[model samples]
Target: MTKGKIKVSSDNIFPIIKKFLYSDHEIFLRELVSNAIDASKKLQSLETMGKFKGEIGDLTIVVELDKDAKTLTIKDRGVGMDEQEVERYINDIALSGAEEFVSKYKDKADTANLIGHFGLGFYSSFMVADNVEIVTKSHKKSAKAVKWTCDGSPNYTLVDNDRKERGTDIILHISDESKEFLEEFRIRELLVKYCKFLPVKIQFGTNEETVKDKDGNPVKDKDDKEKKITTPNIINNTSPAWKKQPSKLKDEDYKSFYRELYPMNFEEPLFQIHLNVDFPFNLTGILYFPKLKNKIEVQKDKIQLYANQVFVTDSVEGIVPEFLTLLHGVLDSPDIPLNISRSYLQSDARVKQISGHIT
Candidate 1:
C-alpha cells in the first residue's frame, strides 16, 4: 500500500465539497447511491454494446448499516475500478471536473447561493463521514481488486484487496456530527425519497410478509401462530414511467407512477401530460395537474428533475417555464449539465432550448 496526497491546485476543494454543495447533509446518501447506479448502468451499456463479455449478475445495490461498527457500506455489482482508475477518478479531483467547478464557484459564501450545481456527488460522502474507503475490482478477468482510503484531508492511501467480486464497495465511517445517517429509519426514508425511481434495484434490509394458507387465509402453525417470510427489501423501481413508451402506459399506469413520485399526496390528478422530445434535446417525463380546488396558490418544487433516471433535484425552475410550476411531475434529460447552478441554467443554451420546448 502506498499513501499519497490527492492532486489538486487548491487546498480548499475538500472543505468546499464537505461544506458547500448542499444544505442537507443527508444528500450524501443520494449521491453515493446514484454513482453506484451509474457505474452499474455503464457496465450494462458496455455489455449491450458488445464490449464486455462477462456476466452482469445481480446488479442490485445494497446499503448495509452496521451500528456496532459505526459504519455504512454501499455495495454494487457494477463496473469496478482498478488501481489507476482509483487514482485518476478519486485522487485527482481536478482532472475529474471538480477543479474547474470549485475554481468558479468556491468563492460563493452560502449553500443557498449555489443551485443546479452538483459536481461533487462522490465527494459528498466526506460531508457525513470522516473517513471513506472504496474496494473495487474491474470486470476484466485478469484485473486485481484494489482498495482506496481517504480521510477528510487530501491525503489518501491505495492498496491491493483480495476481493473476488467484479464490482465496488464504498465503506463510510460515520463521523460524530453525522451519526443520524446510521439510523435505519433515516436511511430508509432517504432511500425512498432520492432512490425510489433509480434504474438499478437497491437493497437495504429484509422485509417480512405473512404466509398464506391453502384457503387464502393467514398460515398458522399447530399452535395457531402466524407464519411469515423474510424477503429482500428492494428500494427502487428498475423501470420508471418516464423510461417507458407513452403508448404502452395507460391512465392508471400514469396515476400509479404519480403516486410513486409523490407518496404522501392523496389527491388524484386532474390531468397529465407525457413529454417526449428528441429534436431539440432528449427529454422524457410525465407532468401531472393536481386538483388545486380552484386556488391560485400553486405548489412549487413538486416537480422532480432527473438526469437519465437518476434524481438530480426538485428545483426545476430554471429548466421549466415559470407558468408551468403549477404542474407537478418529472423531467429527465441527458443534455442537461449536471454540474451547474440554477443561474448557469438560465445562460445555458441547451437549458434555454429545453425551456423553450416546455413553453
Candidate 2:
C-alpha cells in the first residue's frame, strides 16, 4: 500500500474544480465518459498496430447507478492502467494521457477519434463526488490490478486490487449536494445529451423488449400481446449518419438522422449537406435544412459542435457563421481547440477556416 499527496500546483485545486471549473456541474458526466471512450479507442488502435495480441472482447461502456449506495460507476473494457501510469496520469494535474498516446502513436493508429485533450477531466469527478475510486488493470500480461482512491483532497491511497479484467471502473461516491446524479432518469438524460452519437456503445441498464421470432416477427403470447424480454438499454448510436460517407447514405438516411436529432419536431428536413473535409482541418458532419414556416421566425443555435464526437456546445457562434446557426445537425472536428472544461471553444486559425468553409 502507498499513500501520498497529489502533485498539484495548488492545494485548493479540488475546491476550484468543485465550484467553478465548469459553468455547469453536469459536465462531469461528459468528461468522465469521454475519458472512457478515449481508453477504448486507444486499445483498438493498439490492436490495429499489431501491438496487442489479446482478444478484443466487448468494448461497450456501461454507466451503472446504485441509488441506495449513493454511487455511480462508469465502466469500460478499454486500455487499463498500471500503478505507475495511474500515478502519472491521475495524480499529476493537467498531464493528458490521451495527448501523450496520440503523440506516440500518431503515425501508426487512428488517433484522431480520441476524445480526451486535458488531463484535468478526471478531477471533474470531484465536482459531484465526495470520493472517487479507480480500479484498473493494464493490458500488459504481467501488469497487476491496482485501486486508487481520493477523497476530494490532495491525499490519495494506492493499493492492490483483485479485479481480473483488463479495463477500468470509475466509481464516484455522490455527494449530498449533487445527489441528483444518482437518479437513473437524470443520468440517462445526460447520457442522451452528450453521448447520443458517440462511436462506442453505452449501456445504462436493461429495458424490456418484445422478443422476435425466427421469421423476424414479434413473438406473441397466448393473450395475443407481444412477448417481452429484457435487453441491454444502449443509449447511443455507435455510428451516426454524420460519421458515414456521403456515397453510402441515401436521402432517407439524412432525413432519418434528422428525426433522431429532433425527435420532438415532427416536420422533416428539406435537404442535407454532408460536410467532410481533411485538408485545412479535420471536420465531418451533416447539416439539415428544415422547412420554414410562414411566420419567418428565425430559430438560431440549432447546430451542435463536437470535439471527437463529444458534444461541446450548441452555441457555435465562432466555429460557424451566425447564418448557419439556423441549420440543425452536428459538426465534429478534432482540430477545433477547446478549454479545459471543453464547455467553450478557444480562438484558433483552424476555427476561422472551418467557419469560412461552412460559408
In order, what lDDT does every prediction score? 0.79, 0.91
TM-scores of the models, in the given order? 0.85, 0.94
Q: Count steric clashes of candidate 2.
A: 0
- Please give, for residues 1-359, the per-residue lDDT of candidate 2 as tens digits: 99998765557677897789888999999999999999999999999999999999999999999999999999999999999999999988889999999999999888988888778899889999999999999999999999999998899999999999999999999999999999889999999999988999999999998899889899889999999988999999989998899999999988888888888999998888999999978899998888888866556568888887888898888887776677888999988888878888898888888888999
Which window of ten consecutive residues has the lowest lDDT sum in model 2?
6-15
CA deviation > 4 Å runs, candidate 1: 1-10, 94-120, 213-215, 338-346
The Cα error of candidate 2 at residue 93, in Å, is 1.0
lDDT score, candidate 1, position 99: 37
lDDT of 1 by residue, 222-282 (tens): 8888988999999888789888999999999999999887879998899898999977688
The candidate that achieves the highest TM-score relative to the unseen native structure: 2
